[model samples]
Target: MKLATLRRWFSPQTTMQGKIFFAFGLITFLSIVSVTGIVYVNMRDTIKHNAVTSVSDSIRQADESLNIMLEEIDRLNTVVVTSKNTVIDTIMSPNEEISYEWFQEQKRITEFLSVLINYKPYISRVAVVGLNGKVFFTGGPWMDRTVLGTPMLNYMLQNGSRHAYFKPEGAADAITVGREIRYNRETVGIVMVDLDYEFIKKTYGVKPTADSLLYVLDEQNGYVYQSESAPSSFAPSLEKVVEIKRKLAGQGDVMEQKINGRSYIVVSRLSEYTGWSTLALIPLDSLLSESTRIRNLMAEVAIIVFIIILIGSHQVSSRTTLNIRRLRSMMMQVKDGNLSFPKTEIKTKDEIGQLYRVFVSMVDELKRLMEGIRNSEKKKREAELTALQAQIRPHFLYNSLNTIKYLAKLNGVPNIEEVSGSLIELMRGLLGNSNEFLTLQEELDYVFSYVSIVKYKYMEPIQVHTQIEDESLLGCKVLKLMLQPLVENAIMHGIGPSENGGQVLIRVYAEDQDVLIEVIDNGKGMEQEQMDALLGSLDREDAASRFSSMGIRNAHERIVRMFGEPYGLSLHSEPGLYTKVEIRFPKIHHAETSAQEVV
Candidate 1:
């Protein structure tokens, strides 16, 4: 029982309330989860990136300052070697001897070097050594000749007037720059500039926190410098250094490394002044501490939002289902045939409101359809009753005419007997039930009887001319009483009303897919308005009251009803001339066997 209840609750066929609640809740939950996941990932990356950027920028500025100092030292050397005084040239010239001119040039060049050393505080000393065994110096704390004779100095001289950075074996934290001197396209001597390399440590020491470490590595040489507080072994391994060099060769500027099982962010920059790399390593734990706190807060806020969404979705779904349930209940009442129930009304202009309005309209239409059906059934019964009543009149006339025939025969009244005989035959034709259809020959015979009676009743003589175009068409079937009424109407309205009596013409022929019968009379015909009114009334539902002879309208309606509108009566007339009534029917022939048997 519990399983069945659960199935019903979760089924797709369940109430709209459950579906709406489940849909909205699931969507909200999924949306919140997706947004939270994306934001969490981006925030972590952005935090780490900002930390890396700060460290890289610090190292970059230090590198730029170091490069500028190196360039300045080179510039100062260039000034000494290319000096206008030519102090070294005067002293080492094999072309000239040491004289007053040479001494004055030396004094002037020494004073120029002194001025350069004063302006650049980073430069510890500047010296010029001549290959001819002569040397000039500026500043104190001089070094041995061996320090100047390092292989780097020889390399600079071999490469011609270019500068090279050198670290003397005995100097603790100093870098020397040496350049070759040339006079008149000949290597005369060497110019050397000693810069205080400890300045690099001072420049970066004040920037980083005490915990951060900084180091510089030379590609061809080992580590040149490290912060005083940093341990010598704290540097990355030889393999890591080699990897850093390889990575720095490309566009990669930063790499993440795990040193001694601790994560670190390593940023490296290649110096343009020296073919070396400066690398800065920062602990990942410290960098991500604030990011962790933010993530936790975000998780808490997401949970609160999820709960709020559930409550809001439940409320909205409940309201929506309430309106739908009310509408469903009303529809159920309508389905049970209780249309008299109160109409559904919803003031909300939503789709549900439109559905309710459509439901009401459908119910109203159904009610009207039901009422129309009931009325139609009642009318059908009334029409059948009227047909029965009409049938009695012809039967009574047949009986009365028979009685008159008997009286006229007994009294030897030939005219009265003959008239009553024809009247009786005509009455029988109208009363007989032949399925409302008669053969052409049978209909013409009935017409003869009607004309005989009409002739006896009137004093004027009337002629009827009948021309059958096809003899075989005499066997064609048509509506019964179709011709007799037309003949009677011609006599009463068309012929009898004429001062000079007119003859009636009847024609039966076949045209196209139809058989046509025409009744024409030469008499005082109707006016155009009268003819129009008369012909127009033939097609109307209440055409019975529009004519003196109900027979004409009834006959017209019977032909139309039997064979459809195309096979009905049409009138053409002109005043004081002639009037023609044409009748049309489908060309249905009586069976050959039936006609032969009758013959």
Candidate 2:
């Protein structure tokens, strides 16, 4: 049903103006929609990509900066523990005595450790613990022996340098970085640096915005620092945090994750030195805000353009339809037998205007035709009367010929009776039927009648025989008078110069999908050049093969004109031998052939 409606709408039966307007409007609408959709998709992708890139770069920078501060703390702790400065190392070195030199060395190392705190602001506290029960600290004495007891400091003493998140007793959360001390093959002491929130803010310094949040995470523990400005509504759940970490672990730096039921673009960079992750989460809506705005604006612009174009298209179609409608009205009047011609008033050379001019000219021509028809009608009656007077009554002529034949027979004039009978038979064959096709048997009877008339022209009896492969083919339809001319040509041309009459044989049979007829005659044949000239001639047969090929050419062209070029006649002959003309046509039965025959 939809297909029918579509065809009806687009078919030529619809008004031309409506088609033009619909086409223009459809093209404009589709173009606008397609362009708008493409721009929206591309813009969204570009904006999202830029947002991810921006966040990824920011987090990378934050991680690099945090690594720098962590490295500084590491260098400070190493110097305090392993520095070759005799005062600091001697105090940290494992020894067997508490002598006066050791006391001086410890005092110098204490002042040296105190100087480090005043210079490095990113460090909240620094402390060194020795295996010999000697504890040295700066910024506070509370962290002196307690630093080695903490898991971070203990891990450093047992293995190597390590950093861990901690919330000490009566203190805010901080990162404790530690480096183990070793003298000879055995460990002697360790150095620790406590980084507080103020140090974190100064080192990372990545503040969160209303739409974006920043945080530092510890895979082994928990968050080291979370921005104060981070929205509580966008906080991630335990499952989401695991998902985010899992994604990061899979080697991707940026991912989109839903947090608190809102999508967020998360970007993270891990610091290799401190084993901390610097991460940023930006709301998906905020990131795509600019793209959304552009898409909406484009849609609005497209709508405005479409509206303007629609108005213009309507006006153009209206102008185009005006002339066509005028032409239509004139044609309708003509259909109703009104011959009055109107002024077209259309002057432009467009197709519609041309139609108007042609319509007006047609009306003028129609007026001339009406006048001429009236004048021709009177003459037509007069000519009809003249034709009636000149017409010969065919039945009267046939009866008159029969009467002569009977009188000549009664008078014992055999030749005259035979001539009259042949004449009547010829007349009957010519005027008996109006149809172009007849049964093969019927047509052959007419050929026999014609041969009887020509028999008198020869001294010896003319030989005419028919060979039929299938008796059923005798009932097949063949063109009336098709073989008579060929037989006449064969007898007159082939045996006219011979004292003894030659034979003319007709053969009919079916081969594959076609029926073939051959008229074979023992006659004087033409040369190769004559045959070539006769067959190759398009409009006329050559004078060389004139009498020989005329009847054959007529039959060939008739078969072609009736059944098409492929079903035509082919001729073969040899001088003083036999000349054969073959006729080929589609094998059709009598009833089928009679259904649509030429008259």
Candidate 3:
């Protein structure tokens, strides 16, 4: 007897406190884990967000700098284009008697070039290509020799109507700005402004860090014009040039991408009048270095918080276990098959103390109920046995009939064969014992079978139809027999007594992350009084009354038990028109085999 008691005590149901502690520890650990994960994720995202913002700011600053430089270049171009016209008009005028001073005029042009060169130190040399293809007012004699046979001078003579042209000075080299000289719409000569390559290189400024770099490209012609004082090969590649052109074609102003292990924010803006684009490249890591340091500090703070929670949880659990031990000793005295509880004196009003009070109340009520049941035990036992027998009878009968049907099919009894075959399938479904939850496919199949039976039974009075949106949802699990009860309710309560034949429509579909099942019936719907009684019975605290309102109430209970209260059934009816029963639950995919289990 002692061994048996020990066996029972040590069974899977034993160590309730230990299991509780394990669960509490697990819950606390998971809480910490979840909070830590959230903190880490939020910190990482914040760092990335700050990084992106920093990159954007850097790009903006670089763009502004580029814009200022381009504006200066445009101002110089305007002066050259307009001043060339003034010089040409002076040379072409028919008023020769008006004191012609060629040396003074030459000095004025030279002085203008000198002043411009001094103001914008970027301009290396300036020259005017005359209408006769002769050069005058050169910045230096070397520039005069170097650009003697350039296409810029030839193109100006050929297409004198073109206003401005910017091209490379030589193969893979500096940029040259050429403006055609015109007076009263007549082409006379061309002014060529040559900017030093070094000036463009210096525009990028100093490298901010080892990871950060800056460069400029000629957008219109798809060529690298300048890069920070790094290797010439570090300049933007041909592919980058193509991308710039494609993006600029659509007026794309900003682009972010990683290249050569470094993240860059590229900003491009077109010159309003000249159509030349100025682009800036800024590295991502350099911008977000400070944010990363702050994130590390936050992580350290989270670690400290976790340690405090751990120590506090252990102390709380130890104190809670001691209190529970005292309560358990009192509970043991009432476990002798007679409900007689000892009065608990727990003063604390926390959940544990409330639980103790509830236990005492339950014991007191059980003793009173047992006294009442003692007098009627024999009669109630007999009735319960009979009911249990009756419940088993249908199952036995169904199985026996299936065996007979199998025998008849083997004997080839043709007329009996078809009837027997259908009967066997129907009986098998009705008598089957399987899992409480099934895949949506299995439930739909069961609904189809039930509908087939109902259609055969009430062919003249009822019509049934089903629609499924996505067949892939067949793998999603749902409560077994969830739909059949609603269909049965619709046929019996909503449609059976109608004068005209009615339709029952079942629709299943997925919306967002939820699986929605709706059973709609157009029939003689229930009056408000009947609906109130049904709904009231469903809402009752008594389990027996709730069970009696099985179809809707049981489904509602099971859905809440499995998924949660938020996902369950909702009933709507328009008396004399229609009734709709809708069920919504989280779409859970069940494993085909135990090895494929998700949780």
Whole-model Cα lDDT of every candidate shown, in order: 0.75, 0.74, 0.65
lDDT of 1 by residue, 119-206 (tens): 7888888877777655667886674455446675676677546777776543555777788888778887887777776686676663
RMSD to the true structure for each prediction, in A, is 25.1, 22.0, 23.7
- State which candidate has the highest lDDT: 1
Best by TM-score: 1
* Cand. 3 Cα-lDDT: 0.65
**Candidate 3, residues 1-599: lDDT per residue as tens digits?**
98975465446885554445456556766776687677666864565555445545654555566456556755675687676444674446443332456555656667777777677766666777656434456454355434555676675455434334455544434455666677778766677666665655555453444544444445345444544454454456657755755675685666676666666666555555445555556566665566557667766876676677656655565666677887887778777564654565776677878888888778878877887788579779989999899888877877777777678788987545555555556555555645666788777676666655565456465677888889887888777778878887788767766767888998889888888999999876656655566656676545232124568888887887777757888777888899888998887776332312422
lDDT winner, 1 or 3: 1
Task: Estimate the lDDT of model 2.
Answer: 0.74
TM-score of 3: 0.36
The C-alpha TM-scores of every prediction are 0.41, 0.40, 0.36
Q: Write the residue-wise lDDT of candidate 2 on 404-492 in tens digits.
A: 99999999998778888987887887886677877888888888888887888888888999999999888788877778888887888
| Candidate 2, run of 10 with poorest lDDT | 161-170
Between candidates 1 and 2, the one scoring higher on TM-score is: 1
The window of 10 residues in a row where model 3 has the poorest summed lDDT is 590-599
Report residue 237 deviation for candidate 3 (angstroms): 3.0
